[model samples]
Target: MSSHSTGTGKHHPVPKRYALLFACCLLLAIALLADFLWASSSNLSSSSHSSLNLSLDSSNEVVAVSVSTPPQPRSIKKKKEPKAVNRELMYLNATYADIPAPHWDWEEMPEAPVPRLDGFAIQLQNLFYVFAGYGSIDHVHSHVDIFNFTSNTWVGRFDMPKEMANSHLGMATDGRYIYAISGQYGPQCRKPTNRNFVLDTKTKQWSELPSLPVPRYAPATQLWRGRLHVMGGSKEDRHEPGLEHWSLAVKNGKALEAEWRVEVPISRGGPHRACIVANDKLLVIGGQEGDFMAKPGSPIFKCSRRHEVVYTDVYMLDDGNQWKQLPPMPKPNSHIESAWVIVNNSIIIVGGTTEKHPITKKMILVGEVFRFNLDNLEWSVIGRMPFRMKTTLVGFWDGWLYFTSGQRDRGPSDPSPKRVVGSTWRTKLHL
Candidate 1:
């Protein structure tokens, strides 16, 4: 049936079921949107709370919030420090303005009985004893010549032991006794002997000591702490350098030990170097590595020249196993094993062989007197000698510096060769 009148335009009424369904759908949509908005707000609040930990009081008041930070990486670097300088070393500049220039009065004293090289001189009281050395015409002097300082004359002479090594002997003295160690037994460029002997200066008698395990040529020998210490020299071949060090205990001219005890090896080794005990320190200075050797199958002992390395390296041993390096010498010098004397706190080094001449390629003898100051560990050229020489025997007595018996250079300026002389000279030290 039609519910509208034809002429009047009246609208038709909605269905009750349809109206109820539309109202219910609108309410449901609103509730769903509200729930979605509440869920989004809760998620944002939870994310903000996770970063900070909040402490609340009992009244629900916020007190403090602790925020955490990411950790930083650590560095692994260190700062460097400077090295400390040793003031006692030799390279330091020394002041010597107050010191006077050495005049070297240059007086001629009584000459020795024989001209020799590579010999040993020991002063006991007022007497200066010249021991065995390489003598004239390829011969080795096996006798001891005593010089009386008071009389200024050669007082007496005595024959050494027949078995005693002549040249390149390592000698040391303890006031009354003179200890003679290993060296070349016969003469020129010969094999070294291990035979050792001790001479009583008071009784003038030679006593045999236990032989050294290894022989050395011109080794540095000294008496330290009741023991005889020997270091650095040539080996059996006479060309190779020996770095071995040995020591022996002794009391009253008698060996306390039957055999020599091995000690610390030297940093460098060769023959004709100077070894001295000063201020409780053992110092080795100015030596050469290689030396002249005898030619094989040469009946007359002809020496063959080899490349030699001369150095000025200075080493010191101050009561330890290690050897500390000190300042080197002013120049390269060798053949001065016995060409030194201790004057006060200074060591005076006399004539010796320096480096060969560059142009001439010949040996150059050292003429300047070198003074090694033990206090500051410095080296100074004190004065010049009348003549250049090597293997000189130096003695200091009564304020006089005496030198005798060495190989003198030929000609004043020429670096040709050397001649052995028994001439003696002295000068009054003004230092």
Candidate 2:
């Protein structure tokens, strides 16, 4: 058995080179397996990093879209706040809050048939009548024009009595009869006439009345307490202010008294004043102390420029012989004899001549619409006219305020008197 074991061991130990080759082949196989495993791990890590980067990019895009979407709604909220403040300013007085806010816009109406200034307008029923006034240059018109409210047109015109005074006339109406009192008979500062007459509007016939002992220019005439009362005007010289007050009894377009009876004199004497009887109290407001006069020997009757005292003094007559001073106007105003109307228990005075320019010393026209509250006795400026003017004829009918036939200014900036216009304007009043 010993001899067989030694021979088998000796036969197997024949080739050392084959053994070395087998060992090298095993090492190579192990190295190749380890490299394959390492490659697989690296690839997996790279794939995970790429997926994480794509997810982060998607999140960033979502965040950008959310941050850019809100400014449109914020801009729409800032545009709705100014209209509420304007409505409150329209009614200046808190006491007038109960009254509806006046919403009005001026509209043009049919022009008057004749353009005149310093004329008197009377409204009776549906008809509006315009009497004599100063025309172009030095011409005075005695023409009477009638406007029909129903037709919205000037329906008829007629000639005044030859004896009737032309310019600076004192006029009053008792619904059916219009009484024309003393005034400057002819144009260009002539002596005033003592003639007095009454016209029956229905008959269109004029009847002569007892003449005034003293002729006056632009007197304050009104029917009060069954009598035609006249007060405060310029004298026949057309420069002196008269304080004489007279009255005459009348009934049904006929004079009950043959002559006017003298009464209490006015506190102030002036021409181109507004005379109104409200609540049985006669009031005289706004006038000038002096007037334009003709040059002494000019054949054409050239008006001489003179210093005038424009005043805002207001007087009230409660009894037949007593006078009391009331609140003066907000500003000095004149030439407003027919530029006023009574509405809602308030007297509204429109365009007139105001104080001269402080610097230029030129005559200034008023553009503001003034209100005198009869109940409160306070004055406030309500509105502004489209153009400054003087001697405008004002009327109120069916909640509409009408003004026509005034001397307008040259332009908005220029307050100087330029031209006379017959253009009628109307605005609906809420109060």
lDDT of each: 0.83, 0.82
Model 1: per-residue lDDT, tens digit, 1-431?
A: 67757656876789999999999999999999999999788766765554466777899998777674332234744446433322222121222011233646598888899999888888887788998887764788999998887778988999999999888888888899999999987876778899899999888999999998888888988888889999889998898999999999998999999989999999999989988888888888898989889899999667788778778888989884989999888878888888899998999999788766544456777777889888888999898777888888888889888888888877654434478888888888866
Instruction: Report the C-alpha lDDT of model 2 over 115-146, residue by residue, as the tens digit.
Output: 88878888897788988887875788998998
Error of 2 at 413 (Å): 0.4
TM-score of 2: 0.75
- Residue runs of model 2 more than 4 Å from their true location after superposition: 1-104
Clashing pairs in 1: none
